[model samples]
Target: MLVAAKGERFCDQKRPGCSQCARKRALCPGYRDMSSQIFRDLTQVTVRKYHAKRSQSAIASSSQNKSPKLVKAKPSLSLENVALNFFIRVYAPSSPSAWLTYLESVLSCTDANSQLSLSAVLAPAIAIFSHEQKRPSLMYIARRYYLTAIADTGLRLTSIQHAVRDSTLMSINLLTLFEARAFQGRSPPTDWTTHIEGAVELIRLRGNDQFKSVLGQALFLDTVNNIRTSCAQRRIALPAPIQDLLQTLLQKDSPPLSYGILEIGVGNVVDNIIGLVAGMQTGAVYCNDYKAVILEGLRLDSQVSELSRQLWSIQSYRVLPTDASGAWRWSGLAHDYDNPQSARLWNLLRMLRLYLNKWICRAYKKAVFEQQQQQKEEKLLEMGQEFQHIPETAASNTVLMAEYILSSVPYFCSLILSLEASSSSALSSTVRWLIWPLSVVAVSPLSPVSMQIHARDCLRKLGEEMGSAQAVEIANMLDNSETLEDWYASHPRMIVDQKAWF
Candidate 1:
């Protein structure tokens, strides 16, 4: 009695036209030729398992849409419990009011399991736990929550309520921040542009009146800042919509500038300088265009320089009187010195100035080369004399920038330590905000090795305090980038992982 023949199996008995044997031109017995009792089972259990999981995945995906409620409650809240607790302790301390507002919103939400709530809870949790604790399971959980949140948002993306939309955006921002921290320096740099572009569209949909609130304005600034940072880092021209938005906001007749918006303006100028530098470097500007680019760069530099001076002037009025004398020294420590924001801002401006000056030197070098090539010795000599001071000035700025960063450490420490228990939120926020600028100075081509080490040390301390993995990642990244920069100096053809300029 022949039981049902087993399915196709490879055979050692070679047959000329055997399908499986044809490729290798090896021995094969026809499927029908093999006796069931003698043949070994050739079942692909592993492949079957793969198909089974895939089907299950598809089913789970469809189920999310069929009953979105299930997706919301799928992740056991217990998994996020520890993460949520950590967020309150570490992250929320920096932005008490904002956290309070967010807390109220979360508590008021009717559907605790909704995509909005899940994301709001899960992202910060994932971020905090991953940075503070190296739990392997947390990464997988984070990925699941992230995907579900993204999918849920996509399913009902259009015509979202304004309040819901705001919450969604906040979650998206958290997710973006999480990604920035999670990927470390190894991950392909997050193109924050995608989020900003979507945010811009959403802002337009939300209308002008929505920005009257403080939170609205803050969100707007964050979005613009992200876009601005991306453009400056990548040396790309600012997208027109964002450019026009900024221009309108920074118009001459607008209200007196806030420090935050002023920072944005400085970024704008930096972006312009970068764009000009990129053009000059790429030979996109010929001799005829060189003068205009040079003039523009110089003009922006002057504006930034003036802004730096003004920042000092304004900050001077806010300084407490010294015990020794009423007058405050411009370059010395002050009585009860705690604020480093001014110094930080000043150093950043100087860093930008140094970079701009370097580019100016390059422009002059190019011009000199062109004049020499054209046999204009008179112009070449004049250019040489004019540009000779530029490099020296740039070098001086580099030293000054490094000094400013190192000097700020005392003030920064004092500021953080002075915070009363009630003020921890502000303290943490202040420290977190400084990371970008610190990273900037850390990787500057001209930063002294000592300064770089100090910067990393400071970042590590801050990261430990804030449970921010990004700080550690950035420290490692800066070190690696510096090494790579040196290597590339000798080996220009080697590829480098160029990240966004802080």
Candidate 2:
């Protein structure tokens, strides 16, 4: 049926008039005309005593009961735009606690670029860098394993580069480097250099970058510096001098460096122990105790960073808002479960719970959903108490939330338009897929259409609530006289669908 639709935006919402209406403009219906029965629990509506004594110059007592007006919404990014990046970074996002932590975290990596889906997000470089230096010892654990795996035992190479690529040889070299006298203040023997080179090559070829942004050179340098500085400051004794070579490489222009480590979502003092699978035997240079050793350095960086990030996240989420439609809107909503701030908070808490505490990850999985829920509530309450009075920074948070959800409804309407375009059945064509959902939402709310019925209730109630001054204003607005259902059914759909369906 033909309809007098207004601006294209409202076409998904309402039309001014259906074909059946002859005087179209006045026939149009919309929520701007609807009666809302929200907040009806009040047992009495009190008139202001001041109004009884005031002259006609005083505003009417019934004005304040008007509905909360629906204001124009501001623009914001779509959820799909944000979700697109979510999948790519989940797995490697720069820490063992990132996508690598307990196998379950792998579910976050939906993007094509992330690698090492199941390894716990970890900081092995940090661990290695934190050690004390002492007597140097050399060990060759990889030779026997290599002898078992290599089929062509005599692959010859003059340079260290080719020698390490033969997977079997590469694995042996890493073991030798980690055990070498490097940490003991002795230059890493030739074998250690060979292993480091192999790791650099593997990282270049296989490591995913989108999410692996964490373990870059910055992290590596920080760990090495932290450990070396700590050791020097405290004069701690260690069996090897791991920091010496690391310090030398930090000075070099080029090294086989990953970000070396990142501290994005990891926790310190809270999440230290979980089950650790032995490091992957993949053809990477890092089989050099780097993975195992990086954890200690991470713990320190995490200790320093977590407190600040947590406090910031909490402060960001204190204020809640009611949307123009009178629905409560939450903020920083990534996927409805929680906002980025909340996720960061949870990540911090979960990580801290595991700090240096062994078997925590293996135990986290065993914890019930109810237990997790309890933890969330506990944390929420703790933060709520801390930042109870902060005002919301954004006035239009509610408008943004409603508009975001509303924008997508048009897309669904378009889909229904397409479906109706193909359906041949006349009866079926009018039954748009989008209508059922709208009908479900519109059927409730006791709305009054006449000014006599709706305005008195509207003004008296408005007068009873925000006071007589606000009440007179609200009642006048409600005097426009239309039910919310009129607005709902007035929305236009593509008529071409019926022709196609028939």
Cα deviation of 341, candidate 1, in Å: 3.6
Q: What does candidate 1's lDDT look like per residue over 137-230, in tens digits?
A: 5776676666665554554344356333555556556555555444433333533445545666665555554455556555555555555555
lDDT of every predicted structure (CA atoms): 0.52, 0.27
Q: How accurate is candidate 2 locally (lDDT)?
A: 0.27
Best by lDDT: 1
Give per-model TM-scores.
Answer: 0.63, 0.19
Residue 381 error, candidate 2, Å: 34
lDDT of 1 at 307: 75
Alpha carbon lDDT at 143, candidate 2: 28
Candidate 2 lDDT over 244-277, as tens digits, reads 3333443445343332122222311222211121
TM-score of 2: 0.19
Tell me the lDDT of candidate 1.
Answer: 0.52
